[model samples]
Each structure stands twice: as structure tokens, then as C-alpha cells.
Target: MKTSDEPIVIEECYAISQEKVWRSITDVREMRLWFFATINSFVPEIGFKTEFLVKVEDRNYTHCWEVLEVVPNEKITYTWSYAEYSGDAFVTFELSKKENQTRLKLSLTVIEDFPSDIPEFSRESCIAGWNYFLGERLKEYLEG
Candidate 1:
């Protein structure tokens, strides 16, 4: 498993336009379909913020997110942290058009160290969660 010190980056290309990909990531309606279903609201503009609860087993994680940067259909960056945890991280999604496809690169960088003992905070767990969300859930939602 990788340490939290190293940023996790994952890239995938979809047979879709950059505008479509951007909408899926930035728009609350589209985001709810593939990203977080419980997301109450989301805006691509900087300084926008939202929080939602996610339950896993008996543990509840209150996910707090703040949009830090936005570049129309090309890029977006935001802070992702749990209200119940001490760690802080930034998650950025970049989109680029290639012919008839859009390539998306997702990067997660940890600024403050999270509790290492928690299974959910493990680097491996983070990677798996992203893979399931972006590589599987998002992919299926866009393709299917």
C-alpha cells in the first residue's frame, strides 16, 4: 500500500466530449448519478461548499468539500476532508479532449496526515474507493 505522503493519481479516457465529462463532474444532478448520490448541491464556481454524510458499516463519515478552483470544462479542484477527521486533502479533476474522447485525470493530495489506524483512512482504501467511483461507477454511468 502506498503512503499518504505520495499523491494518488489516476487517469482514464472516455468516449465522450470534454463538456459532457465536465458536466458529469461539476453539475450536481449529473454528479449525483455517478459520484455521490447524497450530494445535496454542487457548483463549479470557486468557494462553493457542500457537505454530506456517507455511512459505511456503522461508521459515518461527514464529507466536507469546498471548490477551490475551476476552469470551465477543462479542470476543477476542490478540498476533500471529513468533519470527524483531522486530515485535509485536495482532489483535482482535469479533463482534456482527444478527438472524440475525453481524458480525465484525478489526483488526490493529502496535506495533513490522517489517523493511520483507521481502515477507511488507509491509502489502499482511498485508492479502491476512487477506482470504484471513477473507474467503475463513473465509467458505467457514462458508457451505459
Candidate 2:
């Protein structure tokens, strides 16, 4: 599904255990190790919110995520928006077991209402970035 200017949609699957992968994501300590530069806090409960200071291109940006849905180590959904920009986007993490390995899929949807300031919200870039983060950084962190 296309959202305004976001032409690309990313679909990436990671191989890991549900419990292990869930920790990598919802656990604040584990998230700071691979996901964020500095995470303020991580509360997995639904409706709970958290913010983090992320550095992209040498610029520190404050991003906030509101937990939308949580199903233990099975799935988690949230809406993310950066203070430096506008528009709220949805991100969903789905976990499934496959041959004793957890198959994790992350889906990001750029809300139809694109960010006003950050007009460079290209879905293709988002896809590639997530691929490196979830598929690479998180993967390597878990493997190690």
C-alpha cells in the first residue's frame, strides 16, 4: 500500500527466539545497545509512551513512540513521531515460530498525512534503514 509520497514498502524477516528478540526490542537496556543512541525509557504496556535521543547524520533528534498494542513476546505495535518533524507513523512487530526459530517481521506504514517539515520522507529510505537496523544490528546483537 502506498502512502502519498512513500513509494516503497519494506518487508524484512529475522530469525531468532521470541523471548530473546522481544527483549532486544522492549527491554530498554537491550534497545540502547543496538536500536537507539540513547533511550530515555521503554515501557511495554499499552498506551505507555517513551522518548529517545537519536542521532542521524550528526544531528540529534528526539523521537517519541507510543505503545499501541502489546501481546507479550508475540507482537507489539506502536506509533512513532519525531519532534523535528510532523506526522504519526505506525510500526508493527509480529513474531511467529518456525522450526524452533522465531520469525520476526517488522512492518512500517507512513501515515497518509506525511510530515510537513520533513518532506524527504521517502518510504524507500525507511525500508533500507530498517533493514540495516532490525535485520542487521539487532540480528548481530542477538547472535552475539
Candidate 3:
């Protein structure tokens, strides 16, 4: 259980250039390979919007996202929410170059509370999902 005020933060350092990491995150083609396979379109520009559906168990979650901010090769922020759920959140990805490597910091801030009845919406699940995508999945895609 997580309070609405607490943000989920995950950081990982990748042995790749910031440009490559940025493309993997912002490009829909690269993202679908590691992040979300159902992501139809993604643009790292302010006000760009995209929607996709994710099925968990018997429930369908319509994920609606709108780009809030973008700093090419550096940072991007998006407003993330579910069309069928009463919740609002902001997902921000920041990249910093350290010599030959890039440090990626991901932060997810919940603005509105999601239904507690759904186990998938729990804080633990959210943290685990991000860790899997950023720590394992993305690393493998980039390093491989």
C-alpha cells in the first residue's frame, strides 16, 4: 500500500549512449520491443497522446497517455491514466550521460488514487513492473 503522495522511483545505469537510450524510450518501435508491446504510437513531444489496452485477468485497462514535457535526449514526462479507472499519474524519465554510460532515472507520481481492490494497481506491483521493464527488459534489449 502506497500513499498517493509517494512517488515510485527507479534508477538504472546502462552502458550505452544517451541517444540510444532515449530512442528506446521515445520511439514506439523500440518501446514495443521492451516496454509495452501493445503501444500503438508514442511521440516524445508535448501534447502528443496515445492509448492502448492492457488485459489483466478478466479486466481491461485502457491506458491513456499524453506527453507533458520533452527535452530531447535528456528528459520526457507523460501524463498516464486509465480510461476505465479513477487514477492519474505522471511518468518521467530522465537521462544523464556519464562518460561512456548513461544513467536513467524513472519516476512515477500518483496524482489520484487507483482502486485498492485491484491487486495489479498496488504499489508493490507498480514497482515490480517498472523494475522489470527498466532493470531487466530494457537492459537486455540494449546490451544484447
- State which candidate has the highest TM-score: 3
Query: What is the TM-score (0 to 1) of candidate 1?
Result: 0.95
Clashes of each: 0, 0, 0
- Candidate with more favorable, higher lDDT: 1 or 3: 3
lDDT at residue 109 of model 1 (Cα atoms): 93
Residue runs of model 3 more than 4 Å from their true location after superposition: 1-3
Off by more than 4 A, model 1: 1-4
lDDT on C-alpha atoms for all candidate structures: 0.89, 0.75, 0.92
Worst 10 residues of 1 by lDDT: 1-10
Local accuracy of candidate 2 as per-residue lDDT tens digits, 27-138? 9989889988588888889999987776767565678899999999988989877776666788888878877677777777767465444424555556777888877888
Candidate 3 residue-wise lDDT at 56: 84
Writing each residue's lDDT as its tens digit, candidate 1 over 16-58 gives 8788888899999999899888999998999999999999898
lDDT of 3: 0.92
User: Best candidate per lDDT, number?
Assistant: 3
